[model samples]
Target: MTSDIALSVKDLKTYFYTNNRCNKAINGVSFDIRRGKTLCIVGESGCGKSVTASTIMQLLPTLSRIEAGSITYHAERGDIRIDQLARNGAEIRKIRGAEIAMIFQDPMTALNPVYTIGFQIEESLKYHTDLSLKEIKKKAIDLLRDMGIPMPEKRVDEYPHQFSGGMRQRAMIAMAMSCNPKILIADEPTTALDVTIQAQIFKLMDKLKAEHDTAIMLITHDMGVVAELADEVAVMYMGNIVEAGSVDDVLRSPKHPYTRALLDSIPVLGQGKKQAIKAIKGATPDPYERPNGCSFAPRCDFATKECDVMPDEEYISKSHRIMCANYKAVS
Candidate 1:
């Protein structure tokens, strides 16, 4: 309900129910995203990063259900609350591309292989805005051009196959912002692109965030991206947020064992004096069957018998908190 907070997620637990088992993808995930800032959700693959992103936008798949959560959107129009799982695809449709847009990881899979780029972008514009087809086409082209897609006017008529990977990603960005969404959820957007293109895309996103005042929820495993674009970083492990803080505080001097392990794994240029790469020991636990206590206990070096209890999030500062059993002792 706060004006400054763009999105507030409380007790978010999204689950995927199969015939065999019910997988708790996001377990009690909670966070607040302030307006016009990037909140990077970082974690390993299958740690419920994408699910959490989709849950925020109320865009979960048909079979998967939001087990529990209250996602509130504080918008200029009004405060909208969504019981993410309970809301049907039709109700959630009102938010997607209209208020809360999502830019998926792969543009090729996300974008229509059949429809022209212009048509797809224009379709969203038509649905959200009262813009006519002709007007929407113009807007779509402008958006494409803005995203640095070459000859967007001509390229608008082409299908997905016509453009390069970077260009296609740009098109996806254009499509995401077609309706000028307030909240843009980008799920590992720079994954497959090369370094140059990745830089370009990152710059483009920063530029767009500045110009549009969009609140971005960037979900990725890349710590480099977190350092560059994140105003705040929420480190997830298993299915829960293990640490949340400003980029400066947590990234510079991570308090949690999981976080420290992650940062230590990042290969630096001239720091070979230290030991070899210290990656987290254990693999991410199966979402269907989490451990008895702290999700990261299996891998946490600081973990003790006390970690058998549900670890409490201890606040390091006003802006930083770590949910670990041994943060104080480690410090």
Candidate 2:
């Protein structure tokens, strides 16, 4: 791995087994998250974005297992393969909230309803640092203040239900940043917020990235968010990255059919009301019965007979790659 790369996930395959059936939640996904940069993983629901994040965090459930590949965290101490670590082991536990942190999609469910917001943030500090109780409390207040929550001193003692949707999300971010983690995984952090609040959240994230030099893996289905916040972007479909490149490359010169479909679906700001949105036809394939060839072949408008055989990844440039058999013709 390069020095700039904070984490490298290679050919990661995570599967869930239940009732004699296998659901491939993540299939051969690979990406490198560079320090102080944002890598946005954009795709529709059930495209395995959250599963990829969970796999990296070693937080998969009992029935789910990593069947192949590696997740290498490029730590200051050494390169650690996160996929090989025991789920609840000491080493991973230490790394989970300190070296790496996550802001889950929904704060209402993720946060403990009974505990004060400050208590939750302090819990991470207690495990990761040797700060005294008083110090921890002060730090928690400071974090809440940093998140733009008004009157942190009072709000710290409040429970999750006491805060609004945006404030709760900010509190989750505050808790996640308590330990100054190197890599931050935010799975649709702004999904539940209003437009104004969403803008504030993105601005705050940008500020945090600049201040902490944290590498961020942001998973979302919003291409608008990708265009705004992503330094690099990966278009995932059916558990695989169909295209990946710098934001400009992928957004401006998208090669894969799915990527184009996604871009076309986005409503442009100045486009008149009569401008028709092109929604991608067909739903994602069933994980238990994935197609033998290209997973997207069933939905692609440009799919050919050759699509019945899986296409090898074709490099458009050192920074851009696509997994389409007819990328040349399509481009």
Candidate 3:
């Protein structure tokens, strides 16, 4: 892996086994997260965005298995193949919170109801560092203060329920950053927040990334968030990445049919009054019943007999690539 690349995922295939049928949650997904940069993964629900995040964190359910692919983690000292590490091994345990941390979608469900927020943060600090109890508590308070929490000394001792939704999200960010992780995997981090609060969270993440030199792999469906924070963007459809490039390239000049349809569906302000948001014609295909050729062919208007054979990803520029048979037809 190059020095600029913090993490690289290649040919990742994660599947779930249930009742003798396999659900291909993530098939051949690949992307690179550059150091001190944000790579946003955007797609509709059930399109394997979250699954890819969880697979990187090794947090999948018991029945799920990574059938093929490798996740290379570029540590300061050397590179480690994360896929080959045992789920509960010593190295992975150290890597989870210390090297890579995840901020989940929901703070209410992610936090433990019993423990105080300070204790939770301290737990992460203790696991990653050999800090004493007093030092850990002080660091926990510092983290809360850094996250803009008021009365950090007192609020740090309160349970998760005592904090507001935005506060709780900040607390989650504090915990995820307690160890100063190299890579931060945020899965829909602002899903449950209001618009104003959402902006604050994005700003906080950007500030932290700049200060800590951290790489961010953000999974979200919000194009607004992508526009505000993403350096690179990858569009996923039915478990495959259809297009990937710099944020401007992917959002401004989308090549794939699915990518264009998604942008068209976004409601543009000041375009006109009383204009209904455009909706895609069909829903995503069932995971187990995906098409043999192009998984997106059934719903793609540009799909034709040529699409019967899956198209290889073609590079349009040094950093832009699209997986489609007729990218030129649309653009």
Candidate 4:
């Protein structure tokens, strides 16, 4: 663990056991999240983007278990192997909200409908900090204000149903930021909002990153969101990262066929209406019976017989790496 890196996940393998079948939701995934930087995990749904985040947070469901790998959190106090910690233990409980916080995709379900917004925001502060009730309430209001909510003093007393969709998302962000976490994992924070709200959320995230220097692990499928917010980008397929690099390098010069296919699927701003959008050819492989080789090979235009075996990671540059046997051909 280096001083700059906030967290490092190496060879992570999270699987779900159901009906005597092992579904490898996240297999051999690895990445580093640096302080004050945004790492976007982008791919189609079921690509294990959310699973990776959940694994780090130790919030996986009962049926799923971390089969292998290490999640190392570089704390100011010391380096801690999160994977080794007992899930729901006192140590992980302290670190979950205080050192690292998460903003979930659906605020409605994540938030307690019965509780007042202020109370919910204050919950973490009460548990994580030694702050007095008055101070906690004040901080809750301040966080809401920081999240661009109007009349925070009044809104704090309101319930989740009283707030609009965007407001609920902002409240979620406020709650996540209340503890001043070193790492903030936002799982599609703006997925349910309109474009305007999405832009506002992104702006709010940018402001928070600038002010707090928080390491953000953003899981999203939208390339536009990745383009707007990511400092580093990882393209995942079938629970594995097929390509990763600086956002500029990954987006502009993608090496893996899957990465290129994802990029090509994005609609261009001024392209003629007659121009057809490109879509990836095949569905993601069945989780219970994943391909023995490259997971994306079935859908990859550049795939060949050699792709029948999993390809080792190859570095295109000091910062860019791709896991594709046919990368050179595509390049």
lDDT of 2 by residue, 1-331 (tens): 4999999999999999999999988889899999999999999999999999999999899999999999999999999999888889999999999999999999999999999999999999999999999999999999999999999999999999999999999999999999999999999999988989999999999999999999999999899899999999999988899999999999999999999988888898988897889988888888889998899999889989999988888898989999999987786
lDDT string, candidate 4, 1-331, tens digits = 3788999999999999999999999989889999999999998899999999999999999999989989999998899999999979999999998899999999999999999999999999999999999999999999999888999999999999999999999999999999999999999999898999999999999998999999999999999899989999999999999999999999899888888888777787888786677899978888888999999888889879999999998888999998998788998
Candidate 3, superposed: residue stretches over 4 Å from native: 274-276
Candidate 1 accuracy as lDDT? 0.87
- The CA lDDT of each predicted structure is 0.87, 0.94, 0.93, 0.93
Q: Which candidate would rank higher by lDDT, 2 or 3?
A: 2
Arranged by lDDT with the best first, the candidates are 2, 3, 4, 1
Q: How far in Å is the alpha carbon of 284 misplaced in model 1? A: 1.6
Cα TM-score of candidate 2: 0.98
TM-score of each: 0.95, 0.98, 0.98, 0.98
Error of 2 at 268 (Å): 1.5
Taking the tens digit of each residue's C-alpha lDDT, what string does model 1 give over 216-262?
Answer: 99998989889999999999988889999999988988988888889
**lDDT per residue (tens digit) for residues 111-229 in model 3:** 99999999999998988899899999999999999999999999999999999999999999999999999999999999999999998898899999999999999999988888889
Question: How many clashes does each candidate structure show, in the order listed?
Answer: 0, 0, 0, 0
